[model samples]
Target chain A: MEIKETFGLMARHTDDVIVVCALGMSANEWWQVTGSEDTFYMHGAMGFASSFALGLAVAMPDKQVWIIDGDGSLCMNLGTLLTASGQGPANLKHFVLNNGVYQTVGGVPMTGASRSSYTAIAAGAGVERCYTADSMNALSAVLADIKKPGHCFIDLQVERDDGPILAPPQPFEGPEMKYRFGRAMERRFGIEVFGPEGY
Target chain B: MSNPTVHDQLVAALKRCDVGLAASLPDDWITPTLQRLDREPGIAHIRVAREAEAVAAASGAFFAGARSVAVMGATGLFTCLGELATLNLRHQIPLFMLVSERGSRDDHRIYQEVQGRRIKPVLESLDFPYFRITSTADIEELPHAYEWCRMQKRPVIGFLARKLLKG
Candidate 1:
């Protein structure tokens, strides 16, 4: 029911794939769950993490890429759905943590929170397959479906947290985040993310 | 040897850079080049919904070990400064942008005047390195420009002037 429970369900599936986390709660919660230096945690540019994942997916066709987005972040850049579906890279998956509130900057309710159907919006945006996971059982089923390769969207409904804080963000950020993630990519994939001089 | 037109030369230049991917959102002056990028065999082209997407997408390509570029109009470039500053500048990620250098006196478009007048000063304030490419010879800077971006670990804009784009 909690967002952490949703993340707990997701943590199992993230081991082999690259995850791009949208800044704020999504970034914080994902780190708390996984403690992964390999995932790219967006510190800013709130709405474009989906776009970042799309580019990574296109570049690394042999690998799977996941975007762990948030409701507010998705609304800010709804057009990403069109770009994702138009490109339709089978290696990518979109997951939105639909908690209906901005949990990080304090629990402010997101606009159109209760009324908007994100799955329908994704479908209209041309995503061929969409799913909604409102419970643990539903989330488990959807996660199983995504294990197979395809471009799919999942709207994850979880309980709202009206707390001063939920989970802390990863300690390393900005330049450190870049180097750590880039180095992890090089080590994991046997590729050169930086030049010989290490620039 | 330079190609006869703007798009031709830009495409050839990208090929020389071994750029494997490109993201673009078009403005009229940059439309042909965007189309040419769409058609390039070696480059995987993405047509994004917004200019910030192009900027973010190119930043994403870095982790894949792929050389990438973004294209947009001057006004479009203006739209993504926050993303550029926060995402790219904060992380010190390299991004190379091919942008329409609008707002020149010869352009004569009143709508573009604001973008032309403000874009450079804004870039200066952000301390982002940019080069104005006004002729075929200036195209040489693009390949080098991108390398400098990677070396500097920041956003670099190659502003394609009206003389280069329209001629």
Candidate 2:
């Protein structure tokens, strides 16, 4: 499946789920598809979007959290799989866009991309429900199961392209992004993400 | 305050700061504190495989309106510079980290010497602010430090010295 198609499927499935996107292609494509202020588009922190999503899931046990990760980012901090499994937040879903290349960096091949099985690796790391979807039909078939309550992992095997399809960046950056996301959380969940004085 | 143990005092301090969640990786000096956190009733303790996971996890908790902390040794802190810079610094996420002062003169471990000597200079280069806690009295400042971290909107380190942890 193409990368955009995978994102399109995900966008359709996103029903009040707070998304955290890994930096680069995953974040860019997610922004293009959703244009969501509620989602966090990571500007840096190449490998830990999964960890960040894990934190959010653990904090808000009632809310569903999803991480849109990339092959290169996942390889950079594979230990995140173990941590996520250990926490085992029932509200978290980890999704990897596996194109076998760093599309944002001009399509450099990722390390061990062809041979590495992220689903198997996640299963080994103690994630009980792991799936791989290489085509749109396969992905569509698993969409309901992916949204279920549990620590789940999905490897979306997308076709690699030479360059990242340019998309508009997140409208906010740095502290502005923090405030917007935090405020959105507060409004959605009626939680106090910031103090009375707005720190 | 009546606990007399450093671990208990630190844990109590964290509670005073309203920290509901803690993400931690073990360092010998901080192990006692981590153990206490694990057993604490109100705090959600998460044990992570890497220091960066702890850092990023704590950052994530912040957006959920949950006050959180990350605990690790000095060397572990060194391993997470990229995450600290990109995740915490780049996003201006306030993360509170309790790191053991591993390379101090009293620590005496040769392996930790580099972390002791270089960590501060690197933090300086990154323009990250840190505070050193050396005595029981200093534990009281934790709440203030945590609030300051939120106000600053960046990762802040509270360095726990060997002398303090050993007390």
Give the best candidate by DockQ.
1
Tell me the chain A TM-score of model 1: 0.96
DockQ of 1: 0.88
Residue-by-residue lDDT tens digits, candidate 1, B1-167: 65357788899999888899899998999889988888889999999999999998888998899999999999999999999999999999999988999887788999999999999999999999998899888886678877888898999999998988887
- Candidate 2 chain B, which ten residues in sequence have the lowest lDDT sum? B1-10
lDDT tens per residue, model 2, B1-167:
36458898899999999999999999999999999998889899989999999998999999988999999999999999988998788878889999999999898889999999999999999989999999888998899999999988888999999988885
**Candidate 1: Cα lDDT at B77:** 94
Candidate 2, what DockQ? Answer: 0.84
TM-score of each model's chain B: 0.96, 0.97
List ranges where model 2 is wrong by over 4 Å: B1-4
| Candidate 1 chain A lowest-lDDT run of ten | A158-167
Model 2 over residues A60-131: C-alpha lDDT tens digits? 998889999988999989999999888888889999989888888788888787777999999999996999
Candidate 2 colliding pairs, count: 0
